[model samples]
Target: ALAYAAQAFQIPCVVVIREDAQLTKLQAIRRYGAEIVLVPLAEWQQRLELEQQRRNLHLVHPFDDPAVAAGQGTVGLEILDAIPDLRTLIVPVGGGGLIAGIAVAIKAQRPNLRIIGVEPEGAPVVSESLAAGHPVAPSRLDSIADGLGAPYTRAFNLSLIERFVDQMRTVSDDAIIEALKAVAQQAKLVVEPAGAAAVAALLADAEIERPVAAVLSGGNVDMDRLGSWLTR
Candidate 1:
């Protein structure tokens, strides 16, 4: 949706997907007439910079882009508006864009509201960064949640997370899968693995407070993988 929206608005956009991303995303981008860039895990950062410079791309940092952040902030605003008494918000952290934006908006309006970030255990950049007291790249990137599999944390995202997020948790792939199934059966929502990380954290961690709302970030899942997962 973000890519479509950007394209619709005449923004020359190119999607950067992991090298191993399923064919579904590729097909969708092709169908939508958008450019797709596949970056190998080893060369992502360098290639990204080179590509941006080569194309003179108007780079929009997923986490640091003010416009994108503001757009994500609207989610926090809507949550507060709908649940006036809401005291906490749980957000899944991939590159930290969504949580950073939500934290900023929620804290600005309700300073006391706690904002938590959830990450996949296999790719816990945010959690590991917090532990190391600085942004640290993961030695190995391995996660079923492709969206959340950022090898390195951006400085801008790290700053926002350090300042705004109250807590962070990491959950395993099995836990994430259970959360996905639960949401499918109960909420009737199809969520990607990264999108369900927050729910997985909530289910795995018993200490979380009630009245907590989690962001189900995206619903783009490969049909073949979804069927395989369901059968498993």
Candidate 2:
């Protein structure tokens, strides 16, 4: 979708993906003539800053970008339109982008709605930041949810979440795997571990009530890992 959108707008876009991303993604990028930059885990932040500085890359905050946030907020809009009595929303947190965006959108429309964030137990930047009342980087991050493995939470996302999010929680890698399997087997959807965290929380007696909506963020996962997780 991003590639197509960029092509439609005649934007020269490069996709910076993790080193271990699927080969299909690489093939697709090459097929579309989009530059693909592979980033190693240790050098991700440095390379991101370097790319931003060198390329004058327009950094789109997943949650803080108004347009992106507005689009995410539309999820809240649809949810409310479908179920107006929604009291709470639980979203997975990476750099705090999606939740931050959703927080703003939901709060703007329904000031009293409860919004919560879920993070990997190994990479609990948001939870730690919220505890300290400031954004903080985790010493180390280890999670199967590649999308939610951000070592640090962004300032904008942290500020918004601190202000608008009602609570934050962390889930174990084992729990995330369980959630992924459940989503695949029961829900019949191929959701990545990060995307399935909300369902994991729901299954773990996390205190969320019925009639709540969990954002299944993304479906990108390695096939090998997916098979291993399913067997386990």
Worst 10 residues of 2 by lDDT: 60-69
For model 2 the TM-score comes to 0.89
Model 1, 1-232: lDDT tens digits are 6477776897777766678986776777766767889988778777777878999887766565767877999999999999999977889987787888889999998988989898888898888887888888875578898888877776777888889899898888888889888888899999988889889988876777778888998677898888777667
lDDT of 2 by residue, 2-119 (tens): 5666777888777766786556457766766667779986686677668777998776443446677666767777878988888878889888877877788889889988887899
Model 1 residue 64 CA deviation (Å) reads 3.8
Q: Which stretches of candidate 1 lie over 4 Å from their true place?
A: none
The top-ranked prediction according to TM-score is 1
Name model 2 segments beyond 4 Å from true.
Answer: 22-33, 61-66
Structure candidate 1, residue pairs in collision: none
| lDDT score, candidate 2 | 0.79
